[model samples]
Target: MTTTPEGTPTTARHRAPGAEDALPVPAAAGSVAEWTERYAHAVMDTFGPPQRVLVRGEGVYVWDADGTRYLDLLGGIAVNSLGHAHPTLTAAVSAQLGTLGHVSNFFASPAQIALAERLVALADAPEGSRVFLANSGTEANEAALKLTRRHSGGARPRVLALEGAFHGRSLGALSLTHKAAYREPFEPLPGGVEFLPFGDTDALRAAFAEGGDLVAALFVEPIQGEAGVRSLPPGYLALARELTTAHGALLVLDEVQTGMGRTGRWFAHQHPHLGGGVRPDVVTVAKGLGGGFPVGGLIAYGPDVAALLGRGQHGTTFGGNPVASAAALATVGVVERDGLLAHVTALGERLRERLRSTGNPLVREVRGEGLLIAVELTVPVAARVAADALAAGIIVNPCTPTTLRLAPPYVLTDEQAQPFVDLVAALRADLAAEETP
Candidate 1:
């Protein structure tokens, strides 16, 4: 059984007494079976069946209900940058909560202001950059979308979004997301949005060139995180910047999944491949920003655009709560103080090389920047491979049927990378043998 900070035995809400103490128990339908039963009774089925009852986590590892430990490579979808329960983050949150947990927008907290200032500085845009804090990635996009409209004078409300983009599931942000399945269910989304093929500069230029003043903004992900970690070709961001500027449309970069040192840079759009010279008018960030705490923000550069949204434009009660801001401050401090960007760059290169050198026939390609990587297999069995990896005491994810994505914690150790590669190689061989009949 795991113990909390107070040393009290922590039991799963549904697990019976002594069930939490079971360690290294045989892998059976019974272990996860009990969890599935308890989970169904306790929680909403939003995420479907509980894959595993995660009981405890430390650093880059987590233990299941049966006390089997697995190396966590997904890092809670790239949110746990300092890894699970890092003392730095926990202390920051604890101290801030004790001081002041939350305050209304009528008042401002130092932590909130400090975090905003830090983000503006890190973004390195021109002077007078303003930040609007929010509670999630989708909210960040919503804020940005609203800001764009405010700049558009309401006459031009249309937005140009990239195909295969996954902004968020929220109704407003859903309008900008291109996936039909995610959008169809919530039909009649805030209208006046067009989708363009990702990385196609000509398509973007043509759209804006012909649309003239109708498009309010060009919403793009520097690196499409949900579309199997796809990255843009060199100079695509620069082209977008030029075209958006020429057409009087704001360029809003959605760095929700690729920001906060995930791509070895503070933002993936800052990569040299995107010319590294272009500046976005608005940038939305989340995911790794708060290091697991829920925090998001939309940063608008220059006063003309930054001041578009006045006092009554948009607001949220939990948006800039002190606890979340403090967590974000601590996360940003640790990343900068520890030089984690450099660490991520080096470690990510090593991971990519190791995966590429495995000589596994199933692997068609391995590509990514920094820790956000995807291993694409020739076959569409990534879901099975992810399951197999979990069963083998490692945790990974398949963003698509043939693409295995890895976004391990920035604190992942060199020693931990090889075991995962070896495990995947074994999985590849087993799958190949099964197919060879």
Candidate 2:
């Protein structure tokens, strides 16, 4: 361990390796093919086959077992805020663990307290807003679900969520999540959850008007991540706020994929079109919050809403662990120090514009804001496009059969991002040819 000029302890071992770490060729057992084969037997088949077996990374590029480097546009599904092996994130986690790592919920650490304060400040939350830390986006939504029910003060309280929302996979969160394939097998989930058409002002008004009295809360994603980066229609969030408030139902914004500067703002709900005229009663965040360190949080605004959960009502064993808190704090600090929000805003526009400019026949449309983007293909060949991009040393996500999503690291430069656009444009014919009749 060594100290940098600013006195933060730096673990030199965590730094990206030099030529010494590279192998002439991947070891037989360590190769992607070999590891992938073994993974089938050892690991569950939840996320399907592994895409690639990555060995090491630096900045926005990661090297695979075969020493092939790739520009990671997905950023671990929008979780890597500072990109791979960020010095600040590594230093903060290493320093905090060296000082004080894990502590039970019975105790409190400075890192935990500081992170809570930082999140509250970033949200520009109400004066008495409170924070509840969890380990993942699903866990955060689980906490929020419980809080809403606890405050419902009735035997049965109905909760509403958007049709295209992806809250999490846990049973509680799954109940709020709206996907037939992901939800059908997990039937008999927590009850009283209903789905409403996303971004439909008329439907929102109708739902509330019909059953406002039975509703306890409404959960929505400012920008639908899993649904191919579908953003709420203009003025829709404001409408949601108006209806939820009028019906006395709490409005919850799920920022798991859009928060932490992924959308050029601290929270996507904070965008001018959404945050200016409306205020969410609760906000659930994770993903980039810890910059790949694994942390989630729920911010409840207003005194009444904050007071809903009493001490024994809800808790987590490892929720505000010191190491995770330190990582999140460092991630946010670096985002501000580097002015990444503005960078994302500018770079996002350039990337979107370039993708649209290609004017390729296979391209349908480009959507989303900031670094979170989605390119809809005229044919249902997005999966093929992603596979092609991967073979070409670029990593993008096929969020749907026809939608290719891009949530690159904020640290991704103009040079790095431009190649992705070019690669995708070149892959148009290859992608179209892969389409099944």
Candidate 3:
């Protein structure tokens, strides 16, 4: 067991023994090698091999089974809003579970209703806005897809998605995704989905100009997370809203990666500095919604859009479980009470400034708003940089061969963040030397 900052004890979870682990538990139960070998046989080969056996996490740091601690800059791909083992989050989950845990869709819990209200308010959506709970980001997008199709009224069936966009892995969400590798395996996906050049206003205008009437909705990520944290060009979102509205197409903003303060705003599209002032018909969010508690949501605005999906249209058994809802409620409460949105905004600016100030030869560019950032490398050695970063006790993700993504938890301190810039500078020098003749 590990103790949280509030002195609460958290049970460290370990994988139960499969038939293969019958040999015997190692004296060091946290040994990475022993656990890695067991994982290879029991788990599917989808994610290749496990990166490391993480035993415990507190704040912005996690300890591997080997007892080596690393600053978790990725934050579970932008899911841990409050960092790990937060007392507020823990207390909320515990108290809710003790009172009422899981409830069927037929029944409703206070947390379920309360969380929906909170999200609707946070969005500052128009009156009559509604929310649909789900288990993950993919499910949230899946529900949004169905709602969009229903709102299409059968006359408009074509949907527009940005190139390199990753909505989710479900059939409906995948249809909106543009990655060929993810979509190729599931051939002949749902038809009428069109791909547009990301950040290209002309392409967006042209697509709608050519097939405005046939288009049902246009899905966009305010900041493309998987596409290397690429933010849409200035006024791009506004233009999208104008074009979609003129064409009678609904603007569905996918905030799965940029929502819940990831971009220092409740929703990136709502950030005025990032080109807010535009309202979307549908917005899908997850990742940081439950603060690592595994919850997703679809927030629809306006009465017409909200009523698109009536009763019996769609639902989920574990969508609004009391435990998950309570977790989300507490997550939002803490973010608001602690003023984390403003904190994130300030911290993100400092991080970006420090990185750019390094003037490291290897770092080409650093881009992103708030905490959702990407450091573009001068050479395609991001994978190597990431590996070296791990060795140096810092965690980050190589989103592509040339792009390094950082989405550390909201609780990351300036002291912790400052050193990361220095680490990268040192790592870059090493990498540059290796490439030199």
Candidate 4:
């Protein structure tokens, strides 16, 4: 037994060669209450209290500090593309870190270059398309924001975003987000950002109709995740594309939560119902890009757009690092090698159909493409239902007051997903029984 400098007793599981007191872990590591108290003291209270002190995870199952297991349906809010501790992702990240982990922005690594090329090819980007690597969805949006600013040689200063849009939390990205609660606190954001009604083709046309040349970019999410996984209506995206092209304003699709096969397509915008035949000038991607690893980037399509942000204009220290790139590459490799795209499509449709087949009055509708789904409730009991679902050992997200969002891992089995369907049906039965009384 040894004591940390702060006097917490610890026992070393393994001491590395020539390392002094390394990994002198606290003996009472499994006590959830103790860990939660420590977390309140040590971590910022940004996201309120911790839900559960999860310790270990494998596949779609995670165990809390109390040894209770949970079926992860949220997939870390759609980041765990291949689920937890995937062998391929682990091997790739470990191999890369052991080889060449990081370098300054002035230098480039083989893994970074390879991943960029792979993304460009997978996106079907034309000749001279380029990618600006970043560390998260926010950073990727920041890069895209800068690209929009550099458009029209600064003559067009106005940018358009959508209602219920969640671009990111940073100052620049914050300007484009729609929720007033998120924006009011961070007021005096970057100017000239106007939020239009979501998926309203007429509103989009009217915005472009007035001072169309003043608009530099039109930002949108093919499927709005934080806004309850709402997809754009038919012809809405096509109308956005036509207007932006006619007015010379760049169409920026924020695919942070909807890209990298989350919607069964390589990107959500490629789906016919969402954004078919729409060629966006800028595309931002993150979330599932590196499975559970933190990595994100923006793709600038065509040589004209790619040529914008040249030397000394933008850069990052950890972005495009070899280790993160290797993780993402391995994620893509696994998705391709295992044909998870088709799997996700079929599984997602089956799950949605199963929910609908339950004929539960509590369930208003089931929507979204691929594994990214939402079960809309007829009543505003999403939070209560989500808590109940958690108690039943399945994890889900109350994305909105009336919607339960389910962005489970693509590796989730049909059997693993049945519990949620059963939960909905039981809730309906409970409601009926109460009404009879």
Where model 1 places Cα greater than 4 Å from the true spot, the runs are 1-32, 429-437
Worst 10 residues of 1 by lDDT: 7-16
**RMSD after Cα superposition, model 2:** 4.6
What's each prediction's TM-score? 0.91, 0.93, 0.92, 0.92
Please give, for residues 8-80, the per-residue lDDT of candidate 3 as tens digits: 3332332332435467635347588988999899999989887888887877888888999998999999999
Looking at model 4, report the run of 10 residues with the lowest lDDT sum: 7-16
Every candidate's CA RMSD: 6.1, 4.6, 4.7, 7.1
Q: Is candidate 1 or candidate 2 better by TM-score?
A: 2
Cα lDDT of model 2 by residue, 291-311, tens digit: 999999999997789999888
* Local distance difference test scores for all models: 0.85, 0.86, 0.87, 0.87
Model 3 steric clash pairs: none
Give a tens-digit lDDT track for model 4, residues 1-437. Answer: 12245432222232223347456546326577777888899999999778888887777878888888998999999999888877678778877776788897789999899999998988888889999999999999999999988886779988999999999999999998999999899789999899899888889999999999999999999999999999999888899989999999999999999999998998998988788788888899989999999999999999999888988998898999889999999999988987889989998999999999999888899998999999998877788889888888999999998899999877877877888888988885354344333
Which pairs of residues have clashing backbones in candidate 2? none
Candidate 3 stretches greater than 4 Å from native: 1-28, 429-437
lDDT at residue 97 of model 4 (Cα atoms): 76
